[model samples]
Target chain A: MLGRIEQKVLRGGRLTPEEALALFETDDIHLLGRLADTAAERRSRGRAYFVQNRHINHTNLCLNRCRFCAFSRSKGERGAFELSTEEVLERLEGSPEGLSELHMVGGLHPEWPFEHYLELLRAVKERFPRLGIKAFTAVEVDHFSRISGLSLRETLARLKESGLDLMPGGGAEIFSEGVRKRLCPEKITAERWLEVHRTAHELGIRTNATMLYGHIESYADRVDHMIRLRRLQDDTGGFQAFIPLSYHPFNTEIRGGRPSGIDDLRTIAVSRLVLDNFDHIKAYWVMLGEKLTQVALLFGADDIDGTVVEEKITHAAGALTSEGLTREALIGLIRGAGKVPVERDAFYRELNLYGDRYEDRQGDGAEAPDRFRTARARQ
Target chain B: MRKRLHPEGVVTFVVDRNINYTNVCINRCRFCAYYRGPDSPEAFVLGRDELFRKIEETLEEGGTQILLQGGLHPGLDLSFYLEMLRSIKERFDINIHGFSPPEIHYIAGRANLTVGETLQSLRDAGLDSIPGGGAEILSDRVRQVLSPRKIRSAEWLEVMEEAHRLGMRTTATMMFGSVEGPEDIVEHLDALRGLQDRTGGFTAFIPWSFQPKNTELGETVQDRPLGAGGAEYLRIVAVSRLYLDNFPNIQASWVTQGIKMAQVALRFGANDFGSTMIEENVVRAAGVSYRASRRGIVDAIRSAGFKPAQRDTHYNIIRRL
Candidate 1:
């Protein structure tokens, strides 16, 4: 069964939902990873992408207290926080060195009007004009539409006009309604999330899609979610990346354990094979940790999703990785996985390419000995 | 190589539970998540009742042996281990494969005895075999960084050699994907192969990946810890099978890798599915939990196109499933 899927994937053919599920169930993990690697290579060659970005979760005071969310907090909750426009600028100003992108997402604040989000985006853009702002999710966009008394298109258009360069992929936890009801019933539905992204794409705003796995969602649910995103990409061609968010079970209402490494890699590999229309697949290092992110490179993830200077959402849910990674550390991770590191902006355009000689020429004393290189040399 | 080594077309596994006798350890290795400081509220040395209950459950589940291992408790001496072992042997007719090299080394030091004396005493007191738990990577360069408080590479090898010399066969293990280089891995394999060449005491070689979820090492090497992927695991298992010519068996660590990866490892030169692990706390403390029943393991092996057999501690098959 997996053989047929492998042949199809090798021939640059799209995988059926059934085929994708079969790949998920197959014990031939090496083959699945190899096929995903091949597909990723076809898209991005040997280049692995990361953005020098900072994550500013503007507020944690949320209206929709999703069950799976550990980041969201109710009004006046103990840890609830809402960053002012000045504070957001101060945070961005703290790290301007090689910072090309600002990844801003937060909860749907119950009291904050839609103008507050627009103003925050404008203020951030005015302060750091060079930094591309990839802000908000489809769920957030839907919330803005409801809060602003405007249509979805108008809400996205207003935000885009106020300097939102791209949209992040969150809140699309799992598209399966049965699971989504259990996970985030108060949050936007699957159709509403996709509609927001579809409307954003139609307005020339490229966005990323995500699926939060290792929760209650089934394999069929994941395949359905990816196919839906693929269909949207086929129509609008504006989906920039696909990130499979591994569910972290820490301070949350839903207290399932974290996903195993095999499940994480399988989701990444299967996403690569299934989402053929999506150009980039990200292994979000904040949730995956540094090591599995490197392995995910082999499993078809091309992007490690930026420096992410203070990732709060996953950390609130019990992520063990550092909040942020340095550029050198990112390069080391990519190169350690035996791939070329391509520093990218939010849109994944290559800002700098660190080839094999880049590290040797730099001669950084802190560099660990490249064991993969040594192992290959020995072979 | 697998075909050459096991022409019988059978994959063997030991149905046993790893009972962590205690969580209190002096040698709190940076890479270890199982050990707790003596003063910690969670620190515990299992009471006799709890230990007996675990053993009784293992026996009820058709487990032929108990992989009894624990942390190097500062307060526990050789007499404590001896008494525990004698009591278990007196009650249950089951093999007690307890005490890794580090624990043995620590117990010997506490009692002011040689490694040979320690192994002989423990063997005499119902320790059926030694498990390979402490040999993370047999390179002092890596060992000094990972486990400076624990025994050095030579001491780990010496303990295993002494156990072998005392006619007690032991298993060999390598916990890769930590801070070690590939040369360190090769060095580890070389040490095991060289020792096996002299004593021929190792019954099997088990190589598992380092789970870096909740350990001090995981936080220290936060950016660049190589939590080795499945391919890296397969490569290591295949290389171990090819390199460790003197060793007879290679175990697929389904506890670390999931069952699918372990099944794939059968073709990658692993002959044994490690253990059922009716209860495993060490790896779970590191935030990875993979459970498999005897029937689940048997079905996995069968689906992977190999016959499954239940084996005792000495690699002797007791039943073919």
Candidate 2:
């Protein structure tokens, strides 16, 4: 017999908490996959989207060393590093000319004034006016709010004025109160993290959402986390995508095994199904190994992240997936799945449509990398 | 593969009975063990009461359609088909998915009507869709050796074209692993693809192995393999998904391959589970009795990690689990 919630799904209605929880309990993983695929297809059609961006972790030195975090460090811990505004710009220079976005996130620095972050964003904008700077998780924002003595709205407004294009989805490890208490006690509360994004959305600063799974959280915890995000997406509509971050356990204070491949795929499929209103579901290749990332395209993930160059967050957690992939390689993965590869910007605008006729944008004679440099230099 | 392709995680099946209304056939294809000649005492055409009983049982089982197919009985006229369709449609308000191309061609020839006229008369009598039966291999070379007395390949395509022109939909099938090679499989898929490109009327593609037991062709075709295995079936299903890009849905034949292989095929690119066959006689006559109830199909699909959804004849979801 059809469950009442599943009957509503058949009738094209949104999922309730009871329905969401029931979806997890049901043994029908394929039905979960099918529902996720239907939702993904409804949003993306046959096109799988990715971007050409670089990740810049400004600093690793921090005050809050959350147990799940391997990237955060004490004042003089070995491998602790911080980049100045000039160093950040010099690193940005090495990126390919077609680089469209910058992903920036790091620990909560103790002594550095909030002016350092403002200057970093300003310097990045001054050097590459065309770059979209997606910086700061809600945790970092909360830290900044505490240090600067500003409200969430005012803190977000100041960051937006300083060239923060969007907010990176992080700090939402697991939403259950017990999970939050156990996972990252020093970090902002789950409600506070959501409030930061909610305020960002209300201020017209679109952001993404994420959930770190396969750790201490139960299945109910994961479902409740996604349901909260779904409800938030329903209210503000500022969430562009949902990335289900698989918990990698290597150097963390907690010692647990990583999720299996099937678990990763199931989480992605369920995330796609549960977050119906969100347009894109991302498979961060930096966390899910390269092959699984390609497989995830066929699962429920339409966005295989981007050419992340140097992604230190998951690497700190002992992730085996390569730190980055080239634009051509990303396109190859999407096309290998028999889907159209579209080059999208941070805000989901089509930068280029790489149809059946694939023109190598990296040094190919047809479309040279220097073309982007020339176009930007003209400005 | 299931999640990326469908994203909605809903795998669907229909609760319908494959009612072989008549077992008497004139074109008795060699590989078929189901048909009986008119002179045989065992030959039978369903009486009105029996047909209604089957249909009522179907409704009681929560079935939404009756897939009425059979051999081309020379004694039966077009009036018999028209009345059967009208009777079912008038009484039950259920979908009448009756008649393959060969049966339609045989009816047209017997009534001295054009294929279009025969389809129109059937449609007027409340025929909803055509099932792709008798399409063993679209290659005529194989057809010549397989079933020469049946309508040729061109005639089958012609009947489908006429049905599509009349704005009616149909399903396509390939009965492989019988005297045909890899090229023949490609040829079959290409033929279906070409027609789909023109008409865009095929709702789904079904591929099943040719069952050969207690049949003359099974013994006569020396050196020929009996049928394909699960691996081969999966390879063909995956290739069909890649080849038939225009085709929206591909079905796995759980009725032939059994439940386990069908469940595995969900990963190999089959989005639709063929049917919960409340009644199946044709394949059963060939000495393979694999039964599937609605609950069984739902369980199998759920085990495969997909949500089971009930669908009508048109592939529209009636309910979801």
Candidate 3:
């Protein structure tokens, strides 16, 4: 299977997660290189993209006790807290500038009514009619449905009505239950996690997928993770990007988990080579820091995720990729990484392409030409 | 020349935070985009009050160690470090993982004290450990071209040796893919191995790429035949594993390289995935960005076929997540 996949990948074909996993173990680095290059080319066939978004985690107070989580506070912990809908709205109001998207995701709050979340979404959508609402993870969706005593279909319907445009790929922590049990036991089963994202896709909403690495799993487990995500993406076709998250072993329930940095970069490159289906591989600017993310572009990642006006989850987990980054900073990082910077919409749509699209004023006084003049940005 | 990674599997004792004690530094190293000139408004040689506050915050965040890394200021000396270390131990009673090779060498030169005496003084004043900073491509050609005033490779490794002889263990780092070639990388690893072969006081060897952003190095990324790709990243890991044959552990550089490439570096030969940095402004300021938490890194390693264990500055396994 690995050999066949390598051949196909060399011929510019897609490999399944199973194939990717098998290929990961292959000693043929050249063959693997061909497969990765093919996948990258395929992923970039259309216009490359980036997003201008603000990450507003509604609440840090979570009901489910995921052991690997350092961010979540038990309902009664000193720092445990949830934001009111007005507070969430106020955060959104701070982001009405150039941002066209508000990314909201948080722990499964113990007692926020389903309608309360919808109100949060509805308020932001109503307030900024143009800004797309990319809120919640599949875990939150399942939680809201169970709490509201409504099936997921009805829950999603209500959310869609409340102006939920898409979902950010958090809480799909790992796809394997064996690993998930050890890391984050109470969040959701691996299968159920995929189910929530899959169901969201059925409702015509696109979502991202994520993998948390460098903790307690094996290489085979990583392969298993990519395979699971690829299989699900193949079935649902909803996953737009695959974000491979790095683990920091600080201020968490577990005693120790200091992974090597090189291993982190290797996982990302392998993910790109292996996950043949996912379009964008994001070097999320939050966890790995800005410099590493810039270098990540050469390895296999194309998309450097947005300037998160605010981020709580990674911060809660003792990482600094939280808070905001201006578009100029984002473009600067991307340009420094030596790639053409293209501003993207919420759902992976190109908004504006900068650098070289318009010549420097010293060279050409003419106005910049709209490269994709008819490009319709999908929110 | 078999490769090695200094002292392997030593760091895993307690929590550590990268306290860029002061962004203010006097040196203008070409590759360093993170530092601010000493006179700049943004420049800040963290006051005793600010350092104590930062240390208190790190302790509150469950950190046991602080990496107090900055630049080689021209005027600061042995007294400067003695006071900083003394103040920290005086106030917090936490571990002081401060300074690096160049700073030590510079202080030794300024104080007219031997490297051994300087480290001895710092250790006496409660300096616990040293981060391997100013190690941007450990070749003299790269060193002179990058930062002419900064101590050369021999001086940098000499300080580590003197500290090791004086009963202080420190971490070693390699800043590769800047100006030096692969052979230069071998030089850095070899120097580390030679020192570890004798003193055996080096804790771990960390190699990160040069982030060229807002730096004196300017906007010049190499268009080499085989650039800093996954293959090159893996080679560094594998070679570090092989060349530093006596050094048992090679860390995956998630700071210079992203998490995925860091993972692949595991295959080449890396046993550790650095820190779950609470706050890393230096690398981010240079522009490589990706953020991962305790859960994310653990899951990544688990998924990649290893038990994610958090370690201390000495590489002692603290928690097996």
For all candidates, state DockQ relative to the true structure: 0.15, 0.01, 0.11
lDDT of 1 by residue, B1-321 (tens): 887989988999988888988999988889888888999999998999999999999999999999998888889998999999999999999998888999999999999999899888889989988888899999999988999998999999999999888889899999998888899999999999999999999999999988887898888655454356655777899999999988999999988876656876787799999889999899989988666778878877885668999999999999998
Model 2 TM-score, all chains together = 0.55
Among all windows of 10 consecutive residues in model 2 chain A, the one with the lowest summed lDDT is A370-379
Single-chain TM-score of chain A, each candidate:
0.94, 0.93, 0.88
Task: Please tell me which predicted candidate would have the highest TM-score against the true structure.
Answer: 1
- The candidate, 2 or 3, that scores higher on lDDT is 2
Docking class of 1: incorrect
- Summarize candidate 2's per-residue lDDT along A272-376 as a digit string, tens digits: 777888888998878775545655676678998899999898888866545777776677667655677887787877766666435444336534432231221
Two-way lDDT contest, 1 vs 3, winner: 1
Q: What proportion of the real contacts between chains A and B does each prediction keep?
A: 0.07, 0.00, 0.11
lDDT of 3 by residue, B232-297 (tens): 556677677777766656677766676656665665567777876767888878766667665666
Steric collisions counted per model: 0, 26, 111
Best by DockQ: 1
Q: Model 2: per-residue lDDT, tens digit, B1-321?
A: 445657897888999998988999988888899999998999999998999999999999999888999899989999999999888888897888889999999999999999999999999999999998888899988988888898877888888989999989999988886778899889989999999999999888999987767777877543222245444676788999889988888898988876655766787789899888888998888766656678778877885667889988788999988
Question: Model 1: per-residue lDDT, tens digit, A1-379?
Answer: 8778878988999889899899888866778889999999998888898889998888998888888888888887798899999999989889858798888888888888889888998888888787889999887888888888999888989999999998988888889999988888898898988889889988988888889998788889999999998898899998889999988766889864456566788899999999999889999988776656877898899999878889898888767667887876787778767788887777676667776544364445433333222211100
Off by over 4 Å in 1: A1-4, A176-183, A214-218, A249-260, A357-379, B1-118, B133-162, B165-167, B175-187, B190-204, B208-234, B241-321
Which residue pairs come into collision in candidate 1?
none
Question: TM-scores of all models?
Answer: 0.75, 0.55, 0.63
